[model samples]
Target: MLQYLTVPVTAFAQNCSIVWCDQTMDAAIIDPGGDLDRLLVEVKRLHLNLQAIWLTHAHIDHAGGTAELAERLQLPIIGPHPGDQFWIDGLAQQSQMFGFPHADPFTPTRWLQDGDSVQIGQSTLAVRHCPGHTPGHVVFHSAEAQRAFVGDVLFAGGIGRTDFPQGNHQQLLDSIKERLWPMGDATVFIPGHGPESTFGHERRFNPYVGTP
Candidate 1:
């Protein structure tokens, strides 16, 4: 079975998740934005063998700690698609702009795309290229767990701000309706910030994209 724990990190309060397979205790840290010491404490507490780092996008709040974390752990970095290469390259600038700790840019060990799958021990998560908030954003869905880790794409009652470089409002809406809605309304999603919400609840109550 797949298990996870969400820990809010950095001033952005980004929801960094620790997902693992219960059988083997093999785990992956998703979106280690910052506060590395805190994240590692939880990993040690859980006694999980950390294997890799998975990224949803390259925003400073979502990927700031990726480079250092990967280097320290000797772990493979994966995903967020190739479109976020520019964002990854600008980590230092982003950190300065946001008053965050200096973030070093990194190259993913493996770039992901739609239809790809990532594994942790015995569990598998399907990857979806959900761009709009960022040209290379992606989401991870675990059919077995009925959960989706959607970074800054959709919220409980709001949506991602498409005002950054290369952002497109219509494209974001399209990605939500086309890429996310198909995951099934019952699927609970872990967003980049705030509390989690079910797709069904968001579809019915989310003012930005809810049905009338």
Candidate 2:
């Protein structure tokens, strides 16, 4: 079985998740935006073997610590798709703009596509290219666990803002209605910031994209 813990990191309070396969104890950190020391301590406390760094997008609050973490742990940096290359390239500038610590730009070890899958020990997560908040944003879904790490794509009562560079409102909406909704309304999602919510709840109550 797959298990995860959400740790809020950085000034942005981004939800950095530590997901691991219970049977193997192999773990992957999703969106190590910042505060490496704190995240590392949690990893140790949990007695998990850190394996990789998975990204949902290249926004400063979501990917600021990616490069440094990957280098220090010698872990593979994966996902967020190729569309976010420009955002990845501007990590340093983003850090300065957001008043975050200097963030180094990085290249993903493997660029993910919509239909790809990522493995962490005995567990496997399906990758969905969910762009809108950023051109290359993606979400990780664990079917067996019935959970989705949706990054900034969707939220408790709101949806991701499409005001950034390369952001497309229609495309984002489409990704949610098509890629996400199909995952089943009962699935619980972890957003980049704030609390978690179920797709069924969002579909019935979300103001921006709710069916109700």
Candidate 3:
């Protein structure tokens, strides 16, 4: 079985998930957004081999702790080439600007792209480029588990704000309508913040999506 743990890290209180395959002890971390200590503790407790770090976007709250976790665990950081290169390069400045404590930048070990497949434990995540929150924003889909980690794209009852530099409301809406909505009602939606929701729940009740 593949196990999942969500660790709320950093001052942003982003959810960083520790996903592992019980049989292999192989694991992948999704959005190690902050608080290196908490992530490390969970990794140790589970006796998981940190194989890869996956990012949902380039925002400081989502990718801030990536460098630290990668360096400490000697794991590779992988994510799509953000459409918002400015945000990716300016993570440190963004942190300072937002008063979200300080974080250092480190080059991504690998650039994620649309349709990319990342193997973690016994599962494979199909990368779906879902931008607007940040240029390179994406949602990782695991078909077997019927789950998608949609970072800052579509929240439970609302949607991600596109007020930041490079953020675009239209694009985000399009992304949600075109990419996420097609995932079907049964797909579990795990957003970057707040409680989880199903695609059906969002479609039927999410104020942003509205009734079809």
Candidate 4:
């Protein structure tokens, strides 16, 4: 079985999830944005053996601390696809502009694509390349548990902002309606920020993508 916890980090309160296997205790840290100390504390407290650092996108608030944490732990970094390299390359600038902690860019040890599978202990998560909010954005879904960790691609009662350089308003909607909806209405999604919601709830009420 897979077990997880949402650890909010940074001033943005990005939800950095620590997902692990119940049996082996092997774990992955998903989107460790900024609060390195908090994340480390959680890892130690949980007695988890860090296997990999997973990213959903390269936005500063969602991935600002990835490089540092991964380097310090000597863990492999994975996912977020490869298209968000530009955003990854600008981490230092983002940190300065946003008054974030020192953030440096690092390459993903493995660049995931749509249909990729990520294994944490005995559980596996499917990768969906749901871009638009960011070109390389992806959502990690555990089909067994009907749960997803969707970065900025989605949220409760709202959608990701498309004002950024590579953001596309239309594409974001498509990702939610097309890529995410098929996961099943009961699929609960954990967004980059804020509370969690199911696809069914979002489809019926989310002002941006729900029916009129």
lDDT of 2 by residue, 45-68 (tens): 999999999999999998999999
Every candidate's lDDT: 0.95, 0.95, 0.82, 0.93
CA-RMSD of model 4: 0.8
Q: Which stretches of candidate 4 lie over 4 Å from their true place?
A: none
Compared with the true structure, model 4 gives a TM-score of 0.98
Weakest 10 consecutive residues, lDDT, candidate 1?
203-212
Q: What is the lDDT of residue 161 in candidate 4?
A: 90
For candidate 1, write residues 3-116 as lDDT tens digits.
999999999999999999999999999999999999999999999999999999999999999999999999999988999999999999999999999999999999999999
- Candidate 4 residue lDDT tens string, 1-212: 88899999989999999999999999999999988898889988999999999999998998898998888889999978998999999999989999998799998999999999999999999999998999999999999988999998889989999999889999989988889999999999999999999999999999899974
| TM-scores for every candidate against the unseen true structure | 0.99, 0.99, 0.94, 0.98
Q: C-alpha displacement of 172 in model 1, angstroms?
A: 0.9
- How much lDDT does candidate 2 score? 0.95
